[model samples]
Target: MISVYIGMGSNLDGPVAQLEQAILTLTNHTELHNIAVSPIYSSKPVGPQDQPDYANAVMRLDTKLSAIALLDLLQSVEQEQRRVRDRHWGPRTLDLDILLYGDELIDTPRLSVPHPYMLERGFVIQPLNDLSPELMLANGRRVQEHLSQLDTSDLVIIKEV
Candidate 1:
């Protein structure tokens, strides 16, 4: 099985509940195992500031499927939760991204591993740090070191979320 990290966020239709439910869905998936999730964080929208703040978290799981196959499953989960792509970085019921895929460097037209913008996004960095502080990103920086370089003052841990 391949170890993978998935980033999940929501800003519409009860963001917290949406996130919690998505985690449950991933946990229940038959093909996934040893699932672990980070504490959710609340942060300003990464795109248009006009939208509601986002609830974000990161998940780690072991899967027997290929990257593309896992992406398909994640997209299906988003669609099942009514995610819409009406606008770039727009409000979404659920937005799931493949942050890392077992240290693989994937660059397909449909996906990119180590998520292109992850290192710079507080919403992604903070929660990811919560799960694996010592994790070494593909860029050769420890997760803790990378997280420290970013301004995470705006990130608020949503305890018991």
Candidate 2:
């Protein structure tokens, strides 16, 4: 099995409930195992200020599926949760991204492991730190160390998982 870290977010249609449902879906899926989650955080919108704040968290799981297959699974969960990609970083019922696929580096037209923006996003790193404080990204930075320098002043613990 390969270990993977995934980021989850929602800002529309009851953000917390959306995340909860998606988590349930993932944990119940046959391909994923040894699942773990972090406390949820509420943060301001990353791209636009007009939308409501987002509910976000990070999840770690072991899976036998390939990285692309896992990405397909996440996208399916998002769609099931009514995720509408009407605008870029606009608003959605759910958004899931693969933050890391084990320690392997990957970049493809369909997906990218070690998600490009994860290091800079406090919402991502904070919960990620909670789940795996000793976790290191492909770039060699520990989750805790990277989180220490972020301005997570806006990230509030909305729920503990």
Candidate 3:
């Protein structure tokens, strides 16, 4: 199994419950095991301000699935949670992103590992730091190093899972 870090967020249809249920679904998946989740955080929306704030968290999973296959599973989970992608970074019942897939750096039409913008997004960095502060990115930078450069003023801890 490989280590995978996933970023989960929700702003619609009871954001907290949506996140909780999504985590539960991941834990129940046969291919995904040893799931560890960080504390839930409430953050201002990254896109249109018209939508509500999002509840976000990071999940660490040991998985036997390939990166693309894992992406498919996450999308399915979003669909099951009634996610709609009508708008970019729009409000959704659930949003799951493959933040880091082991130490591999992948850039394909469908997926990007290290999440491209993770270093700039406090919502992703904060919880990721909570999970593994010493984690090194594909490029070799430490998780806490990137996190320290971000402005986390918009993020607030809701509670542990």
Q: Provide the overall lDDT of each model, using Cα atoms, as 2-decimal numbers.
A: 0.92, 0.92, 0.93
Global CA lDDT computed for model 2: 0.92
Per candidate, the number of residue pairs that clash is: 0, 0, 0
Query: Model 2 clash tally?
Result: 0
- Local lDDT at 98 for model 1: 97
lDDT of 1 by residue, 1-161 (tens): 89899999999999999999999999999999999998888999987888999999999999999999999999999999999999999999999999999999999999999799999898898888888999988889899998889999998889453
Reference-based TM-score of each model: 0.97, 0.98, 0.97
lDDT of 2 at 14: 93
Candidate 2, clashing residue pairs? none
Q: By lDDT, who's the top model here?
A: 3
**Candidate 1: stretches off by over 4 Å:** none
Give stretches of model 2 more than 4 Å off: none
Instruction: Tell me how far the alpha carbon of residue 75 in candidate 1 is from the true structure, in angstroms, after superposition.
Output: 0.3
RMSD of each: 0.9, 0.7, 0.8
Q: For model 2, what is the alpha-carbon lDDT of residue 111?
A: 84
RMSD of 1: 0.9
lDDT of 2 by residue, 101-121 (tens): 988889888887789999999
Considering only N, C-alpha and C atoms within 3 Å, which residue pairs clash in candidate 1?
Answer: none
